[model samples]
Target: MMSITFSGWEAVKDRKNLSANEEPKKGHCYMMYHGTHLQNAKTIISRGFQPSKDGLLGPGVYVSRNIEKAKCYPLTVDKKDKVVFKLQVRVGKVKKINCDNHPMQKTWHQNGFDCAWVPPNSSISSIRSGREEDCVWDPSRISIVDVACCVDPATRKELRRLIQHNNRSGGECDLCHEESDCNPHPVQSCWQCGKTICAFQQKHHCKH
Candidate 1:
């Protein structure tokens, strides 16, 4: 298994089991993050992530190795309303698609790769943040570790208390306890006007 740990200050402070440095190896488990609104985070905890029908990489669950990048997600949601999902991803075979229009951008999975990676600061014009991103083709390969709620329960009526996870070593989604399904698309904020744009409709966003 290929395991690489980005033990930024957050990880060291929160997850001690995560080490500082490691090389990427195929089939290794990695700690990644996914950002969403409070409601969506709750739903994801109840269920598991569903692969998107289409995205920048097409038909995968978008995630980031950098928690800072993850925190910027669901771009339209206010920072306080957002929550980041810490995930343990068992990235199988990996493909690097560093530029737009790469021959394998959307077909990496079909070509036997389990994940498509966009390196940080690559020449992808659509990426305003220049942060590392990943698209895992199989939803089952990803598991939620815990949820970091950015919103304060004292301020939000709906968020009475934050989601808590005492054990970080074991990962299990609520899906195992019940039966349910969801088809959720990725969303991002337009760099210019802050409009929430669907990943598929990115080109049409901020057309002023």
Candidate 2:
């Protein structure tokens, strides 16, 4: 129910400097619009909403944002008494999800999480890993473990059951196999080498 309303969309028709009439900027493309739900609603737009064919705004570098439509912005008033509705504010393209960036070093990704290299003087190693000679992030050095990745061993084990549910083992293991000797075992016994393996396994441990 809290909203700021604008009036006189008709008056902006003659205001050539207003954005709705302009073609928008080219580089670092961004656009903003303002208006109201009233009879004489007014709007001001900054750049193209999104790249398009007939509305061909930019073919080069452009801003990227989740809110691509003008109607999605929530209307709110600032402390300075300025009525503003901001939607789809795009700084740039979506390079990665779960990403973090620091000013001084290289950017990398781990377990689908983005990582930014640390500045030379800004990093200190964690006591847990105890490798202070190496440069590391000082912010508790969060290590992301991918629970849904196929490459990481732990994640592959976690996801194996989901992806290969119908495979040889139905994600169960026999306690009998844990012991040295057991005849009838629920664990998967390799058909080739006849070695009992855990039901929940990434692969049958066949060393041959």
Candidate 3:
């Protein structure tokens, strides 16, 4: 594992000059977290993230600067199955939509803004969690840097599956072993071997 030099969480917390109605400065990069089920995390780690079709903030990837807020996601997945992804995001242009039916709640992206932000507890009707959140319009602007596993002491079955995967795919899983015909379009190309393998087989092909 590589050494981490900066604390993203703390950096965001340190911005004390902004008022409640203000949004974070745009055209800057920050560290953020996205929480999801383990199964979904695996797919994202391999195939890359896809923007949501629709949400409170419209078509974008929802993330939080607060790790605690991120941890309470899906509201359905078990704690042991939850995984939080650490990402580096470039919020190109920002818009603040703090209240319900704020006019720009769902159309911020359609505007010139690249990100929409909701301040904590701004709207009881909209932000039920009373937590700060951000919706990034461009998925390409966000990059997953690391994943924090919530599960510990993996089950015997899970451990066996992981071992088998590592052996077959060289520490890669998910996309690497999927059937070639599953997607008609090319998923991605292998980086290590420079082979044009199916996105589902990139890891497997790279090792071979």
Candidate 4:
């Protein structure tokens, strides 16, 4: 279970381009950002800005087996930006795919020679704000390991307030019979329909 942390938009671009095969240089290992819901804290936490997926990249995260030898360049967009969040990933869970002859490549990229494929169930672990450069282990051929962390108290309070205010009355969840509680803490809100949903029931409410 190797852990690598990257900050700034450059890392973000590298992650996306590596997944898409648009990167000029190909390495044995790559890093990806799977936490999309943390977009609000992207710049603040060094989560990297989301790049447009209009190119050869598919809609999933991809990584190389040999990320230690991977070389990163300076930011082309924002050079002076400081490192924000240290994205920690447990690479032991990654599933390998033959980038050369994977069937999914046909749909992912028009030119099959480019781009990579991400296996199902790939996820992220913890993320922090700091400058920690250490390579703990290699994720190339390791099995999955369990890792968990608690949410911050301030974030929890804020979520609770947001849920209560957005839910209001008559905003019962379509999936679950339970209505918004007096101390509701919604994880997702539908601005189009003005509905608030808890984290557990977000999938049933939104299509995305």
Candidate 5:
């Protein structure tokens, strides 16, 4: 069994008590954020080491509804430091997992967390970056909630606040009401115009 963990600002791939850099035998996992973060600080914040292309790397982006696309970053293997990239696309089936009502976990150090791809039920204590499928991105792809659907109260509170701000309340059928503040109808939200509508205004999905 091998172990994988984040320490000193890098995802360290360790095996049998020896660091990947010092180990005699190389483990299967690779160092993902070789230079993405600053290793000098004992106190660090994880922007979630993405390959740098996933489009969410911008500074001060926290609006949940604003994460429109998956950014891409290059993946490098240990053996040769070969430069190749893996496009972490959104899993269409689960891309909209709606963390809207869920509370944010303490595990997340930043607003929009990074994708730490680890296998299901497999401890990072001794793990490897086996394949692209072995890991996954959150919210836009596959959310971290897959391991457990239940979330903490604080995170749920934060998510609810974001959804409301986005006008995606998923609330009452206001279109059917006498006074419709919701032009698009029910359960509709516009990232561009930043408004929510109802079923009657599905067209708003396009027009801001």
Candidate 6:
């Protein structure tokens, strides 16, 4: 597991002071978090944001204005075991796509454009469908400042307890119902299914 030391958590939180205003400043620095499956947390931290089809604004990174609001996102609330990440983004240049005249009105009606996803693709004209008209921002101008796992003291304790329980109980594999062993046959819970299964059996149990 990634180290969840106090210094690490404090280091990430300290970045918030880079900006003076509560809202995104002239530098376009914003603090956001993506709530997702525990299995995907490491991938997201490494590769940066990937647009998802299930996302409200179609395929794009969705972020809340604040950490508290981010904690309320669907994945976090639905899957109590899901991981939430504190993300730092520095937008070099951004276009306001949330107003009344925005081209992607059909999907943007949700006002998701308020925190829109800027595609990495080069030209607005290159984007197919009516979405091409909405692809007004240049993604290359954006930079991912940092990504960190959000683990509060309470959450850390809960995670530790869960791991300890899994190690001690050697819970039944949700896949084959075989008794799981912690030392050699470690048990891991499926972030989506909420089932405890042998870590090696995850491939057979999870389609995701």
Give the best candidate by TM-score: 1
Against the hidden reference, what TM-scores do the models get? 0.64, 0.14, 0.62, 0.23, 0.18, 0.39
Q: How are the candidates ranked when ordered by TM-score, highest leading?
A: 1, 3, 6, 4, 5, 2
Name the runs in model 2 displaced over 4 angstroms: 1-80, 86-93, 97-99, 102-208
Model 2 C-alpha lDDT per residue in residues 122-161, reported as the tens digit of each score = 2233212211111111211211111121223543354334
Residue-wise lDDT of candidate 5 within 49-94, one digit each (tens)? Answer: 2322232222211211101111111223232221111111222111
- Indicate the residue-level lDDT of 87 in model 1: 76
lDDT of 5: 0.25
lDDT of each: 0.67, 0.24, 0.66, 0.30, 0.25, 0.41
Identify the runs in model 3 with alpha carbons over 4 angstroms from their true place: 1-22, 153-208
Cα error of candidate 1 at position 140, Å: 1.1
Candidate number that wins on TM-score, 2 or 4: 4
lDDT tens digits by residue: candidate 1, 31-58: 8889887767656655668778998998
lDDT score for residue 115 of model 4:
36
* Two-way lDDT contest, 2 vs 3, winner: 3
Worst 10 residues of 2 by lDDT: 55-64
| Deviation in Å, model 5, residue 16 alpha carbon | 39
Error of 4 at 111 (Å): 15
Give each prediction's root-mean-square deviation over alpha carbons.
19.0, 27.6, 12.4, 18.0, 21.7, 18.0
Name the candidate, 4 or 6, with the larger lDDT value.
6
Clashes of each: 3, 4, 2, 5, 21, 0
As a TM-score, model 5 comes out at 0.18
Model 1 segments more than 4 A misplaced: 1-23, 153-208
Alpha carbon lDDT at 196, candidate 6: 59
Task: Look at candidate 6 and give me any clashing residue pairs.
Answer: none
Q: Candidate 1, clashing residue pairs?
A: 1-28, 2-25, 2-28
Compared with the true structure, model 1 gives a TM-score of: 0.64
